[model samples]
Target: MRKFTIALDAMGGDFGPHISLSASSKSLQLHPNLFITIVGDAQQITPLLKKYQLLNHNRIKFVHAPETISMEDDPVSVLRHRSQSSMLVALQLVAKGEADACVSAGNTGALMLLAKHTLKTLEGISRPALVSALPNNRGGHSYLMDLGANLQCGCDTLFNFALMGSVLCEQVEQLSAPSVSLLNVGRESNKGNDTIKQCAEMLSATEFINYIGYIEANELFDGRADVVVTDGFSGNIALKSYEGMGRVFFERLQQAINTTWYSRLLGKVLNPIIKNQLKNLHPDLYNGASLIGLRGIVVKSHGSANESASFYAIEQAIKEIQWQIPACISARLESVLAERDCLSHE
Candidate 1:
């Protein structure tokens, strides 16, 4: 009765209904009062829902939307023709106030375009950046922003990115005076290019942010800062590299254990411990990234997401709605910008 419902796109990701159904089963089981309106072709989703025995639940409803948005299709064109497409329908539900949030594992570009076009950005927000929560060696996690949204950015954009990332920490991470840092090659005050130098100055001069100096790549895993801000291009490459390194290490560890009898025995003993230690590094756990600064909370999961990943995304959407993160962020930004404007006048 809390009026918390999420609009999910059943046809978004690579695995489509399979992942969606599995995630839905888990989500519905965990939250009895929660409702989800899955948007997709009835012909495709009905069978899966029935097979999973989720068809009869009053809380679980299906909205008949038959079109699909392809990864290769033009984002604008797909949103136009595929008016009934699962992604568009899900977003529309959020825009129309029927759902609290929208979750999609579909084309990232298309989702951003539709979210911007449909719900529009918060007042004064230049662009919405894809932000993720990543594990830190110290403990818990940190927020990394502009992971895959903008490529070419100005110093002002980076400054705004820092503010947005901090707002997320305050709202989602519940951190007071969250430490903010810039991604750069060195910690020196005069390091790298003009962009880095200018951003360093801006961050140092910021009143709201707990401005830490430049953090190197190695410091990212060491928990050097709470919110790390960078352009989308650099942030994307860093995220991909982190994932790639984790996979390579996991596979190598498995292969080393299979080579001989003694090694196999040792591996069996250590595998469980190793897995427990590395659980945070799994893609399934961190697959969902929130497109911050939007009017509604939009969670973008990996395109190749499986059931586990899908479920995490849906769960995140639920929490975002509960926390009213989008609304809180908008208010925070407006306040911060207003304060800055008043100071400039003084």
Candidate 2:
């Protein structure tokens, strides 16, 4: 069995090292080839390891980091300074090739900055995209990109995001020439802004991309396309809104289910069906977002992730490490860009 080491920022999340260690413990159970280097204050982690009965585990190691980057830290500041921070240190390990991947339930801005500063972007990739795969209507997952990494986007960057998102869906989702769509206000060719229109045109004309045209917000989660392309600002708002709405929707439904004696009785009967639907909507289950276009696999777990959520992030890291996701994206990026360049010159 091939071994894959993940550098985990054990000090970054809301619950700190304890939650990270618990998640690491759960991950170790499933991935026998996995080894993890926990980066945090050694004292804080030692007790957790003992609690988890992981004190002498051969697969686990500890790297003492003295500092941390807070959720409010500016991305530029973290990038410029904070080299010894738990977030940066974890990224540094991946940069130095000591780890196959890095997983951190840290501040999104800080994590993205630290990753880009340490790992840089892949060739032909202008910036790394914050991507996550969400369950879709057709029992498949749709890959959405630049979730919160970029605030603004240009045509070329949008194109790159599309390529990166495409590579991810193809490699991870096992889709052959997966369909791509521009997240727009409407489906008409000229509906969105100039950048989106350009991206749509390029994608539609590209022979390899199964460009399916624009996807409105409602249809996106319905699996209208395999890849939904959007900039960071829009994507971030959309994602958070979706997650928030999911929470409210579920809570309201549960409240209604238990509103009356008859409703409560009916809820018991329909509990399994409702639970199966709710399972897919849980943000914790899809807690980790991939920092795509990086040189090494880096998964950014939500800073507020709980135990099982952090484990989900670790599992994401394993899949990316196992598939050599970054390398695969590089190869496909080179091919796709070369084709586009050739076409442009034609």
Which candidate leads in TM-score? 2
Evaluate all candidate structures by whole-model CA lDDT and list the values in order: 0.85, 0.87
Q: Which digits, one per residue and each the tens of the lDDT, describe model 1 over residues 1-346?
A: 5768889988888876778888988998999778999889999998998888889988888899888887788887986787888899899999999988899988888999999988898877878889888889877678887888787677878888888888877777788988999898888877878987898788787687788888888878787799999888999998888878877988898899999999999989998998899888776787788887789989998888889989999887887887888787777777878877987999
Backbone clashes counted, model 2: 0
lDDT of 2 at 32: 88
Which candidate's lDDT is highest?
2
Tens digit of lDDT per residue, candidate 2, span 52-141?
978889999888898888888887887887778888888899999999999998888888777887899998887888989887888889
Model 1: lDDT equals: 0.85
Provide TM-scores for the models.
Answer: 0.95, 0.96
Worst 10 residues of 2 by lDDT: 200-209
lDDT of 2: 0.87
